[model samples]
Target chain A: MQYITSLITATAKPPPDNAAVFSRWFVNHSSWGVLMTVDGQGFPFGNVISSSDGGTGIPYFYLSTLYDPTGMNALKNSKSCFTLSETALGTCGQADPQFPKCAKIALSGDVLRELVSVEEDSKEAAFAEAALFANHPQLSGWPKGHNFTVFKLRLKNIFLVNKLAPARYVPIDDYFKAI
Target chain B: MQYITSLITATAKPPPDNAAVFSRWFVNHSSWGVLMTVDGQGFPFGNVISSSDGGTGIPYFYLSTLYDPTGMNALKNSKSCFTLSETALGTCGQADPQFPKCAKIALSGDVLRELVSVEEDSKEAAFAEAALFANHPQLSGWPKGHNFTVFKLRLKNIFLVNKLAPARYVPIDDYFKAI
Candidate 1:
């Protein structure tokens, strides 16, 4: 978990016109975003959390159910949205974050905890863990007592706003294909 | 609407030891964050949006109800949450954002739009508009047909995680006093 002391421009930015490529590039380059989950009261609860896509266009998170409401909320109701802004990447120029040209994406889906003990998905879980630690090295040293586990967003929708026109929903297939 | 192309450290940061003051400082210094709203189907939808407090403790926003789902959701169900991370301020150093010590604050409340036409709250609405435009100059030039308006969080709870301990719920009164 490295704190960004200053904003730095991304090495490369996919053109905004290319939704699939742009979304993938945005997700791969960004290390964190807001993860929203349904709270106990059935209200929306947004938490700033670290994430990694492992370049697969699928977001993975290392979460602690005991200490974080996000993980707890996911266990009860998997419906969630992971949102990222190009503003965080330092590539939006002078565009306001809410400005259409600034670029923002919301991945809507069910958040399910990865079962590392299961032989079938263990490899994917390991990959996700490696990805998380690779981007967020400090995650490796998180407390074991906190009961951290890997969770992944099963993306059902990819909503992106990058141009001055109305926002577009990037096709899920296209998102994966971009990678 | 300023783009943060380079991360710059916040000029000053409040000591994380104090919950009330720290929360106010965090909220005041941050220009943008993820605003979470419940979708029609009861799923959490997180949007990256700009905000301002105008030195006040309460968060104010300029939103386009015509183009943004967040404002629409708020109109239907006022229950919403606005979250900000110290990492965004570039003041958290090397701490992992999720590492509690980096500091994060979540304001949970009903997001009500200010009725500028009403006589009683018109002054407050005017102040909110001025505060927003002061921070985001481009907001004033946004498309008028978008139906943008001032919205505020009638804060009910302030959740802060600043230390390596359990997060604290700062007393609402103390938060206002901190301003």
Candidate 2:
């Protein structure tokens, strides 16, 4: 007797707004993202760190030389990817009720050129500088002993999952628009 | 005239537990991490994804087969690296941050194997299967139709910031112990 098997399928809807979803997802669900970069030899390297200016309303970052050698490598490589996800906690047998799994994201693009210091011409840079400092108080007294550089990500594509039911994807343009 | 250049420096205390710090940083700063992998020619490719997960105490992932071709390539090439930071935001201007950013971790390891089905006799097989199903309810009825796979990352070494950070050389045993 030949038994007929049926196949079931489900499709994920595009997020309401790519950028908005991206920003909200990053802000609401996680506090850190991995930065991936390839050395001159093309070997992949990753690092974990805290998010500076990322939140529901913002999707950008404020990279510093004192903390990121991977970003430094990214500057030199000019091509890299960033990933973020919820943490996974149960598989290893920790009693934490919260399942600490992670969703993966890959941000590939060239790091834009660095911006001048937010301290330069405070009067002229008030709006942008104030906004940055206010949102990220960790940067209050940072400029004095540190060198700052700003690089914008020329996004390529984004992938996401909520570990809920069905996973989803976000296109590059859609991601920017959502934010 | 002697010019006084005041340098404000704060000594960063290694978190009581590196694993806790790593896990916390990843959970709190999800938008900044990068998922990096090497290509067929050994070139790295990165794409940012909106990350979320089941919140398992351990870091588990449900990867989609649809758009993860590059991820497959990287896994095939060698172990991939994930990097993230918070301090880089200060000096890097949405590029990199410093200070608190002094903490960075590199999770290096290979993709051990990808499992799609759970065996009845496997360890935690029931729990693992239930967890998988719960996370992908769309596959509830059509277990056979689900194309999801669970990839195992056999962590090798966790390289922290400064290249010489004591926590940088985290062995897999240490990771397991931390939890």
Winning candidate number (lDDT): 1
Candidate 1 lDDT (Cα, 0 to 1): 0.84
lDDT for model 2 comes to 0.44
**Per-model C-alpha lDDT, please?**
0.84, 0.44
Please give the DockQ score of every candidate, comma-separated: 0.64, 0.23
List runs of model 1 lying over 4 Å from the truth: A1-11, B1-11
Q: Over the true interface residues, superposed, what is the Cα RMSD of model 1?
A: 1.1
Model 2 regions lying over 4 Å from their true place: A1-32, A40-43, A48-59, A84-106, A113-131, A143-146, A158-179, B1-36, B39-60, B66-71, B82-105, B114-143, B160-167, B176-179
Give one digit per residue, the lDDT tens place, for model 2 in A16-129.
334336434453343345555676666677655334232222223455555456656766775655555433211213211112223444455554434445444333233334
Give the 10-residue window scoring lowest on summed lDDT in candidate 2 chain A.
A1-10
The digit string of per-residue lDDT tens for model 1 on A65-104 reads 9878889889999999999988888888899888889988
Pairing residues by index, what is the TM-score of model 2? 0.53
